[model samples]
Target: MTFSIVARSGQALGIAVASKFLAVGAVVPAAEAGAGAVATQAAANLRYLPQGLALLRTGVPPADVVAGLVAADRERAHRQVGIVGPEGPGATYTGEECLDWAGGRAGDGYAIQGNILTGPEVVEAMESAWLSSPQEELDRRLLAVLAAGDAAGGDRRGRQSAALYVVSPGAGYGGGSDVACDLRVDDHPDPVGELRRLRDVHELLFGTPDPGTLLDLSGELKEEVQSLVAERGYASLDMWVGVENLENRLVSGKIDPVVLARLRDAAPDGK
Candidate 1:
């Protein structure tokens, strides 16, 4: 019913999943910054998500954790799972009684699994995309992996939902939480494309500013920006940024060009 990839990149743990089922995000993906990621589908034992991370937190290897989980379940023969822990190696498990075309692959930093898929090519495409993807942020990379599978004819039942979840130390808004990027398309004719659009907007609003693009607000440029800010009804430039939730685009008295353009676009008149 679902296809998923659980992977580790640098210090990030992430999962990208899509299914014929609805709201897959609410149930399929889970990860902790320094612990691990888990995807439980096909007769999914929801407890495996939390329990898997707990085991990884305690230094249990992914293979051993999967072994323990399956061994303890009466429905072991029908479950499908993937795990990537803080330690030794990643692992994937497809139960003996899972639906046709069910299987998995695990090695190095990723585990890919799918059940009731159009064909084995779905998993193959995901694995290839993950292995060959550019050195970009984990969020983007995982989405590429998901899209690859989706293009390969994803779940034979059809697409309805998709999600991408990633976690890393101090990666959330204002460095407040471990959750990095969490986007979902609960039900859509093109869930993967919708997921990609949400990610693009997320990057615009919350992505880290590029250090090389930071510009000092000074002299004539500063005065012009001040005028734009005042034109928008804010007493100061910083106030304008605060009012519009653009604080993440401002840093140490400097601004990214994209943020400046955004302000210019919103001022009372053209720049």
Candidate 2:
């Protein structure tokens, strides 16, 4: 019913998933900063989420974690799980009783898995995308992997939900939590594509401004900024930015380049 990847990128870890199931994010993906991440599906045992992370936190290897979790469950044969621990390579498991098109793969720093998928090619495409882009940030990398699986025919039953979740120490909003990126498309005809759009908006709203891309706040640029905010009845650019909860991206009195683009896109008549 789902295809997911559990992975690590430097100090951050994440899970990206799409499924025929509603709110797959709430059930399948779980992770902790500096600990590990897991994808539990195919009659997913939610208990494996906390339990797997606990094991990984206790220095249990990912392979052993998979072993111990299934061993303890009376319904092991109906479960499928993947784990990437605090260190080393990742691990994956598929129950004998899982749906006809279910399987998984584990490798360096990541694991890719799915159930009721089109075929093995779904996971194969995911693995290829994950490996091909070793240098992307964690959130982007995981999204790319999920997108590949989606393109190859994820969840033979069809798509309804998708999610991208990532965590890194002090990476959350204002460095308040472990969650760095969390986006979900709980119900959509093109959930994967919707996820990509949401991810772009997430970056626009929450991502830090790149100094290299900062635009000069003078002349026509400054005038345009003021006009865009006024279109929404705000007298100042800062007011609109604050109202939109984009103050973080408005650094040092300068608006983020993406925010400016967004303003232009939102303007009436494409002004």
Candidate 3:
């Protein structure tokens, strides 16, 4: 019922997921910065997420938590799970009673799990794609893995929703917003594809630019700026500023006397 990426940042770890079920997020995953992440699915026990996270917060290992939860659950045989904890602790559990072909895989840094899926091969494809995919940012890499799973078969019942989230101390997820990107496709023809498109827009706005923001000018910097814009097929300050999308209030036809004198004094040639 869920697919998610859980990751650590400066002082936090984030968990993001989506599913057809209502508030599937509340049921399928848990994450903490110093602790770790866990995904419990297939007749999912929603309590496991918070309980698992709490155990992890106490420095318990991910495998142990999985084992403990399985031991306590009477229906453990029908469950599917994936866990990754601090320092590379990872594990996956697929009970025999789980619906046809249900299973999961755990890797060095991630876990892929699914149930009532098209087949065991679906989870296998997810794991392979995640491991072999070109190295990229966590969200992008994760989307690729989910996309691969879908292509391989995915949930036999069909897809419904998708989500993405990341937590960082200062880096904005998109366009300087404090929250890194938090997006959802609750209902879509191709939910994962839609989420991927949103992530692309996030990168365009937040990703580092190929050409750095640089400013260089000859003669009086302000005047040179003015002159350069005018030479660039613009007629006046208004036209230059308009083409550059600079606010008009920041400049005028005549520099204020004080500002003009300061610029003149600062200029090497004292224009």
Clashes of each: 0, 0, 1
Which parts of model 1 are misplaced by more than 4 Å? 267-271
**lDDT of candidate 3 over 1-271, digit per residue (tens):** 5544444333434444545555455467655545677777788877787888788778777788889988999998978777777666467788898777677777666767777777778777777776676456666767777787778777677777777655444545333543455566677768778878988866643454322332233357657646544455555446543343333222333333323233334333222
By lDDT, is 1 or 3 better?
Answer: 1
Error of 3 at 205 (Å): 4.1
Clashing pairs in 2: none
Model 2 TM-score is 0.93
**lDDT agreement with native, every candidate:** 0.90, 0.89, 0.63
**In model 2, which runs have C-alpha deviations exceeding 4 angstroms?**
227-232, 265-271
On the 0 to 100 scale, the lDDT of residue 169 in model 3 is: 43
Writing each residue's lDDT as its tens digit, candidate 2 over 1-271 gives 9999999988899999999988888889899998899989999999999999999998899999999999999999999999997679999999999997999988989998999999999999999999999989988888889989999988999989999999999999999999999889999999999999999888877888889888878898898888877787787777777777777788655667877877777654333
Residue 148 lDDT in candidate 1: 96
Query: How big is the positional error of residue 136 in model 1, measured in Å on the Cα after superposition?
Result: 1.9
